[model samples]
Target: MKSIYFTIALLFFVFLFGCGDETPTKETKDEVVEPVLDYYPDNVGSKWIYLNAEGQILTRTIKEGEEFSGITYKMWQAEPPDAETEIWQAESSDSEAEQVFFRKTIAGIRLYTKEIDKSIMKLIKEDFKPLQGWALFNFTVQSSFTEGLLVELPLKPGLDWLVIHIRAAGTLLGGKNIALTLRFTGHSSRKEIITVPAGTFECIRVTYKYEGKLEIAGEIPSSYTETMYVHWLAPDVGIVQIKDAYGTFQLIEYDLTL
Candidate 1:
C-alpha cells in the first residue's frame, strides 16, 4: 500500500507541474518585439517615380555624392530636366536630409530665379535651420523655395514639426533691392491605408502651408501663399506620393538599387 501511495503521489506531482501554466521561451519573447522602421534610405542609385492626377509622371533619383567647401552632399535630381535640384548632405537616409545648397529660389511664389542664370546665388540663411534643416534663400532673387524638415523619421500620427523658413534681401539691380520672407509650417496629422500603382502601403499623411511675402525697394509689398499634401511615406519605405497646386501625385515605381 505504501508503494502504491508513492506512485500516486508521483503522478500527482507530475500533473501539478507539467499540466500547469507554461513559461515563454526567450525566442518567443523576442518574436513579439517588432523591428523599428527606417523610413528613408538615402543611398546612391535610389530612385522614385510619381504619377500626377493629370497622368503626368515625375521621377527623382539620387546621384553620386558631391563635395562642397569641405562638406559632402548627396545630389537629389529630377529627371527629364527641371528648374532646380537639392544638395542633401546627411550621413543617413533614414533621417531628414539637410539642404546645404539650393539651385533656385522662389523670389516670387511660382516666380523662381532660374532663367536669370548665375545672376543669383541661393544659400542657406544665417545657419537658420528648421527642424534642424538648412533654410535656403537666393541672394539675387531674395526669395525661398521650400523650407523646414524635409522628412521626419519614425513617422506617427499627431507628429507635427517645422520644415523650413527664409528671410533675406535680394541683390540690388539698377539701384534697387527686394526684401523676401517665407515661413513653412508642416505636420504629419494621421495615417491611412493607401493604394498606388506600385502596391498598397500604410502611409502617414503629411501637410504643409506656406505664408510668404516679397517687398521690392520701390513697390508695395506683395504676398503669396501655397499649400502641399503628401501621402506616400510608407513604413520601411520613403515617400511614395505627393500633391500640390501643380497636380496630384501618386507613386508608380520605386527602387533602392544600392
Candidate 2:
C-alpha cells in the first residue's frame, strides 16, 4: 500500500542518481609537440677574402703560370698584424692541386706558398677535436672526414637563436710554446628577417679565445691574443656580411653554386 509505494519511489530515485554518478568526468589531454632544428645544406660553397686594416683590398688572384710560376695562387701587398696594424691575408683554393698563398705586409713584405691538398674549410673541420676539459659539440669525425664537416645541426625552434661550438688544435711555428687551444662560439637567427647583399639573412654571432704564442720565422714574434667575429647569412641570403671587434667585412659577391 502506501508504505510500499513510498519505498518504491525512493528506490527509483536512488537508481536514477546512481546511474548519473556512473557517467565519466571530463578530462584534459596533453598534446605532444616536436622540436624544430636548424637546416644545413650538404655542401657550402663560398669565397672568403682577407683585407688589411687600412681598408685596402690586399687579396688578388694570381695565375698559376704567372711571374710566381709554380704558384697556384698569389697575393701582393699582403700584410700581417703588427703593433700598429693587426691584419693579414689568407686564401684557400678548393683544388686537389695542393696550392695555398699567405702574405703579410707590415714593416717588411713577407710571402709564403705551400702545396695544400685540401681547402681551408676541409682542413679546419677535419682537424677539429674536442678539448680534454670542455663542453662543446659532441661530434666525432666519420669515416670520410668530409662527412664530418657537415654536421646535423640541432636546434630548438621559437628561440630565434642558435649557438654553435667550434674547437680545434692550431699549429705553432716558432720554438715558442703554443697552447693550441681555442674556443669559438657562433650563433645564427631562427627567423629569416635580416637581409644582406646576397639575399635575406639571419642574425649570427661568433666569439673566439686564443691562448699561447704564434710566431713566424724572421717575420712576427710569438704572442698571445684573442679574436672574435660575427657572420650573418641564411640559405635564402648567401652571406650578408661579418662584424668583428676589429672591423666589419662585407660580402662583395657571393655564388652558392661555386
Candidate 3:
C-alpha cells in the first residue's frame, strides 16, 4: 500500500510539472525605434529642388568645402542668382544667384568671412573698376556678413535667439556718408507634419524677424521690419517649404548623397 501511494504521488507531481512545461509560450515582436533627425544635415552633394507658386524653379546644392584662413567652409549655392552689386558684392560664385560658405562653430553655424575681403577686392577689380585707385567708401562694418549664425541646434518650440546684427558705415561718392544697421532674430515655433511636392515630412516650423535701418546722411532715413514665419525644415531633409513676400516655394525633389 505504501509503495502504491508513493507511486501515485510521484505520478501526480510529474503530471503537474510536465503540464506546466507543456504550456504554450507567448511570442513577442521587437519594437522598432525611428532615428532622430538633424535640423540641418550638411552632407556634401546634397541637392534640393523647389517650385514656387509662379512656376519658378529654385535649386540649392551643397558643394565641396573651400578653405579660407585655415578654416574650411561648406559652400551652399542657389540658382537664379540674386546679386546685390550696389553695396556688398562679395561673392564666391559668379554663376549662382546666392552662394554662402558655412562652418561649424561653438556658437552655431557661422558664415565664413576670411574670403570676404578677397571677394570684395575682386568685385572692385571687375564691377567697381574705378574705385581701385582710392577707397571711395571707407567702409567699416561692426558686424556685416562675416559671422552670422544660420540655425541654432537642438531646436525646441518657443526658442528664440538673435541670429545676426550688422552695423556698417561707409562713404559713398567720397562725400556722402551712409549708415546701415541690420538685425535678424530667429524663432523655433513648433513641430508639424507637412506634405509638399517632394513628399511628406515631419518638420520644425521656424521664423525669422528682419529689421533694417538705412541712413543716407541726407534724405529721410528709412527703417524696414518684417517677420517671416513660413519656413518648414524637415529632419535630415533640410528646407521643405518656404513662404515669403514673393511667393511660396515647395520642395519638389531632393537628393541627399550622404
lDDT of 2 by residue, 1-258 (tens): 223212111111001123344545453125354453223211223233444345743121222222234533233221222110111122343342222232212211123322211222243333332322222232221111110111113422222221111222233322322222222223333444554333455543323222323232344544443333444444433235545543655544433332
Query: At residue 86, what lDDT does model 3 achieve?
Result: 15
Task: Tell me each candidate's RMSD, in Å, in order.
Answer: 22.9, 26.8, 24.4
Off by over 4 Å in 1: 1-34, 81-148, 170-178, 214-224, 229-231
Candidate 1 per-residue lDDT over residues 67-165, each given as its tens digit? 445545455656432212222222232323321222211220111212221222222233222413423334533324322255454456676554445
Best model per TM-score: 3
TM-score computed on alpha carbons, candidate 2:
0.32
- Provide TM-scores for the models: 0.55, 0.32, 0.66
Could you give candidate 3's per-residue lDDT for residues 1-258 as a string of tens digits? 223212111111001123344546453124364454576777889998988878998787888767876778887776753221111222445653567777654445566643444533333323322533324356665644555565676555676777666565667674777666666677878789999988999888988666667676677987776663357888878889976544778999999985
Prediction 3 global C-alpha lDDT: 0.61
After superposition, the stretches of candidate 3 with alpha carbons farther than 4 Å from their true spots are 1-36, 82-92, 105-107, 113-139, 170-178, 214-222, 228-230
Cα lDDT, model 1, residue 8? 15
**By descending lDDT, how would the candidates be arranged?**
3, 1, 2
> Which of the numbered candidates is closest to the native, going by highest lDDT?
3
Question: In terms of TM-score, which candidate is stronger, 2 or 3?
Answer: 3
CA lDDT, every model vs. true structure: 0.49, 0.29, 0.61
